[model samples]
Target: MSKQKKLRKADAATIRRVLALIAPYRLSVAATLVLAAVTVISTLYAPVLTGQGVDLIVGPGDVDFAALITLGVQLLVTILITVTAQWVMNLVNNRITFQVVRDIRVKAFEHMQVLPLSYMDAHRPGDAISRITTDVEQFSDGLLMGFTQLFTGVLTILGTLGIMLVIEWRIALIVVLLTPLSIFVARFIAEHTYSMFKVQSETRAEMTSLVEELVGNEHLVRAFGYESRAEERFEKINLDLQRCGIRAVFYSSISNPATRFVNSLVYAAVGVIGAFLAIGGSITVGGLYAFLNYANQYTKPFNDISSVMTELQNALACAQRVFDLIDEDPIRPDAPDAKVLPHGAGKVEFDHVKFRYVPDVPLIEDMCLKAEPGQRIALVGPTGCGKTTLVNLLMRFYEINGGSLRVDGQPIDTVTRDSLRANFGMVLQETWLKAGTIAENIAYGKPDATREEIIAAAKQARAHSFICRMPNGYDTVISEDGGNISQGQKQLLCIARVMLRRPPILILDEATSSIDTRTEILVQSAFEELMKGRTSFIVAHRLSTIKNADCILVMKAGNIIERGTHEELLARGGFYAQLYQSQFARS
Candidate 1:
């Protein structure tokens, strides 16, 4: 009820989502609560026995050894039972909490796989990692601690209140009257912390992003001598995070002590009131002691729960971010009527295709191109002139706005996305390799590739010699994100991956950009040989790269201004000729 009353509208939704995450673990939760309840009962019995033991003291306040020993044995048993129950309850609670958190993390990762690249483009990968790793842990810790305290705290309060009433109604009234005062103070302090905690969460995420960026590009930062600037940026974010954390903690710090102080006042009132009741012979000394113990017990849960109010609010803020990501609509799945695409002969036709990164900003309008089986198509233009965009469209990475893209006489959209993409191989300007052995990275697209297949592909991509020079050759483990290897080596690994796939169509977007001229010539020769029977789309900034292309579409701005082989474009003395000559002239 306290948690329910404190939650605002936004938190209400997040709380529900978090509860949904726990719904599947209802049996474990129920078992944990049952253990907690047993612990509460065992715990509540101790103070009652303590008061009874006090009742056995001699009239002159001398030690009643024989009776004291008997009571001590009972008290020891109660304490052991209480301790054992709590320990087992804690074990169960932790298991449930971690499993609930793990399930959410797994679901979030699976959702990420189905999300389109457009979503990834709009957000940083580090922020997503924070949601899965940082936020989930925060939520799990709060839930774990919250559950342990909540179950026992509730039972302790209600049990103590009932026992206090049975012991003395007058003292029970004092505790009942002061409970609201403690709650009021806690609520006031906790309300202010919610906003501060929200800010703290955002600041923490910003710091995570900065750390990821700096570590990811440590080489670039040092090469450019930007260490001071990086430190300055980090200090700015770190200070902001520190300030937000201090304010959030400061506000939360006030809540527990304030609640405890209010409850302490009630404790004093109960003591003062119980003494008078005893003096008037209305209740026995034993009754007085039991009521005091019960009154303290009744108020302590409120204090304990108040102590965790700040933690709960911080957890709720994290829960909101994680839920926001979970609630994101994933990329559209294949249509209900979608059919599997047959193996391709690589006949691609772009029929009056229209595309743009953003709507209303026309990039490629009414663009037409046709590539028969075994033809080499080159797209050449300045940066951002829809060269890579064409490759993206052909591979169905982005859906074309106003056209049908067909492969071997079948409309691409009519088939399942998996089958549509399975026929094509791509090597982008940005090469990606995971932390794995050289053989594993090369065999990424085809996990079952034989050792000979892997070595053959590596040799064709010109990666074999360098790979052999490494300590473990194909079995050597690369560092994270392929950072241990050179950029050209990473590119070669990517090329080797594509070569192993041997798809019917290929898209090479400046694949040779990272290598030296000498290495590029060798890699290019391997690619040229590999491209012989596949429909290939090559996007090249270097005009010389397209000299032998079967067809080259010279793009300017977004549209193709000229189309021909290299010789025809030069003879026309047009945009292509001007662009081609300008490169050599500069060199």
Candidate 2:
């Protein structure tokens, strides 16, 4: 696997694409923004009232009762309005954020379905899960909170600044100049912190993969005495993840306190300047007091804006990772103009087909073979000699690198994958069963199969006798991957599934290799019945298994070296004859 690269800062195009996902909720977002603005306006009024109340109490005459009461009531009303607006904004933000996260997760999973098998083979399952869970959660929390605080902070700053300038421009000028310095400091910190977040995400994904691997293969780990090694590997990943997380937190942690310190200095400067202006008789005492209050209010928004700026950068890093996955091109299937395979008569022809899993290592080279309807063709080869590769090509798991293969005289490439695969039945060496009842596993290939049909298929595979002997018979619940059953039984269940499908073409890849000799005899008899009217491709390591095949093809080093009926090949004394003699001679 290739090493994952660090996440780059998102560009304008990527940001625009992320924003497009929320376009459908524009009206709700607008309402939330309006509420945020109203709340900011109401909050700004509280500090102004404090100044008014101070002036009212300090008036030359006896305390102005009417003025005091009026100011107090206005402050109370503004506080109530501010609280109500905040409540509404929170409700709206939560609703919108949840919906956005839901849509992102659903789309990611749906896209996985259309991706090519090669893409999945290259990525770890746990890493993919981390993207959907941890990364998305981070995005939702940071984006929703940052957007709300940002809008409110800007509105609050504008309202406070306008009031401050009206009372005294000099004090406001000091605040305006000092605010940019704080923003500059925040931007610098965020730039450095963003890199740390990217590292943290990758390290976390690695840790998740390690845990998944250990859990999925616990039995093998214990059998191989790998507990200590697994723990050591996990500890290394954990330490790396911790280091990355610490760096990210440390960089972001500086922003809040730094902003507060800068705001404190600006507030002091406003107080000193306001006192000088009042002494000079350029402003009334009441106006100077109000200007001082508005100065503090102005700096408060700057502090909030600076804090959110740091958080937004982290979210942008995560969004970059998410959008990168979403933007990958899904594999294209056959086009609408592609020809549909006619109802196949079970004839299969490989016309000079060639294939390679990687660029330089060819698995099949200039291979050609033909099987008439109902013919049983056996493919015999040493390990990695391309027997399984042939079956994979016939199923179109990977497209041919060169030449053509046809079924019933039609080129396989022209047919839709679904249409071609629908007519084939396969039994792999390793049987995989989901966590369900025995009946359900057998009926997996044909979900609409009747109960009687399922029972018949199981009987035909010679699995019905053992299945009936189980406590619950066909209703017996299998564990995931059929872990509760023996390896041979799992293979039998898979055979039963393929029998249920009853397709015109059958491919068996080491299908009976797991069973005992006696059980193999029973399965072989049932398989003969299944292959009676269908073209079949059988791959077996044991020569005894394929001795009765209509024709046997011997393969070596990606090329067919010999082909003949069993007796003819034995009499010819070629590679097949030698392999058979060596194997059976030992037994």
Candidate 3:
């Protein structure tokens, strides 16, 4: 939680941006403010009534019972009206604040969908979650508290000062001069606390990320005997949070006491000044008493407002985090007149393509490939030799740096991304199964898929039999990353999801890695059936599986070194031949 030093930026702009979020609820906000004004006015008049009641009993023998009874009723009525007004204000304020937060959270989630993978790679998932949830919650709470403080603080300070000035401008000058002291004290403390509170917020998000990572892979941590190491890391973070949290709280806590001390001085000076004015024949006894009451009331808003400035700083910091998230660079947008791709023969051709995650370290350069409709293309290479990189280019996950790609003779960049991606179905080595019933997960790609179609796809994936054995069968929920089932079972569910899609182009990258050999045979048979009458790209290390491929691509060091059928490459005695021989030797 160490502080990151930065120059304070302009807050007027940030405040305006936050106020814009509240603009939509102006009607409710206006109504709330009206009620708040009534509450403040009622509260400010109570002190004057007390002065009148005290004046009615000027001396021990000069008491006025009739006037005292009437003043007492007036005081009680004012209190009841203030309470009612405040109650209504709370309801409207809560409604407006909650609605604004709901919109902000929804906007964040929607923006998430359009952001590029590069952005996500740069930030932690838990940090993003904290911004949308915890940060928004903090902002909402701070705003609600600040609402009442804003109305009451301003009105009380101004109203009390006006009354004091009307009674005696000499004492009013002293109160005015002393009031700025409380503001200066508040400003100095708030500035220091701002940095500390900001650090605490960042540290909290980091802690949340660490916890999510550790919990998500608890089995991995235990398997590698890394529990003790994880605990050590968490303890370090926890201690940092404690140090930062204490400093931030301590700094903000002093503002109230420091301002109160200044307020007490103002009170003493006013009391002494009012006594002289009372004795000088310039003010009545009742006027002197009321002036003292107004002086105290004037300073109370100063203290309350200082405390609220602390809340305001926190709210601004949290809001900046959310705005930063919403401000991330989004994915490359479609062409202005981008059109939906027309269904055609799936002929994919890569022409002098170039790509690399890093600018200088080229991973794929001057690559070329051409596949006909219904052809089974297999890409075989050692890990990190650009097999996945090539597939990533085809799916448009990473845009090629230099050259263009075409599908059915149309440049892919000329069409909309949704249309291009909708034409392709993918199943990766890493399986993804969201939380839902088995049927729902399977029908993810094809939302309108029928029950019979789902069962058919599950049967082809060799998952139907096991699914029926579960207590709820296809209706069983796959909770928490599908941890309730076996990894192989999860992989099968992913395959079933893709099978239900039945798109024109298929990309299977190590699609059968986790399955046992017996299950692999069944899954391969299913893939053979699914690949018929479709253009397919297969990335596999198991050379045996690609023996019957229409064409095999042998790649190394970002270039295709060999290309042929299995028997043809074996006869050539090249890289692919050596790779096949090494596998056979090991077996």
Best by lDDT: 3
* Residue 106 shift from truth in candidate 2, angstroms: 2.6
Q: Supply candidate 2's per-residue lDDT for 543.
A: 88
Q: What is the lDDT of residue 213 in candidate 2?
A: 86
Error of 1 at 518 (Å): 1.8
Candidate 2 clash pair list: none
**Global lDDT of model 2:** 0.85
lDDT, model 3: 0.88
Sorting all predicted structures by TM-score, with the top scorer first, yields 1, 3, 2
Off-target runs (Cα >4 Å) in candidate 1 are 1-7, 61-64
Which pairs of residues collide in model 3?
A: none
Q: Scored by CA lDDT, what does every candidate get? A: 0.87, 0.85, 0.88
lDDT tens digits by residue: candidate 1, 1-587: 56535557777777788888889989988997788888888888888788877777726767688978988899899889889989988998898888988998898889888887778888887889889899888888888878889788888988888878887887888788888998788778767777788788888888898899899889899999999999999999999999999988888888877888888899999999999999998888877887887878888888888866767888888888888788888877888998998777999998999887788798989888899998999999888888988887877878888988999888888888889888999999898998889999999888999999999999999999999999999999998669988999999999999999899999999899998899999999999989989999999988888898999999877798999999999999998899999898775
Clash statistics: count for each candidate: 0, 0, 0
lDDT (C-alpha) at residue 327 in model 3: 85
**lDDT per residue, candidate 3, 1-587, as tens digits?**
22322425534556788899999999998898789789888987898898898889989899999999999999999999999999989988899889989998998999999998778888889999988988899889788878878777888888888888877898999999888899899989878877777788899899989998999889899999999999999999999999998998999899999999999999999888888888898887887788888888889888888889888778877887888889888888888987889666789999998888889897888988999999999999998899988887888877889887999887888888888888888999998888899999999988899999999999999999999998899999988569899989998999999899888889999899988899999999999999998899999999988888999999998999999899999999999989988999775
The most accurate candidate by TM-score is 1
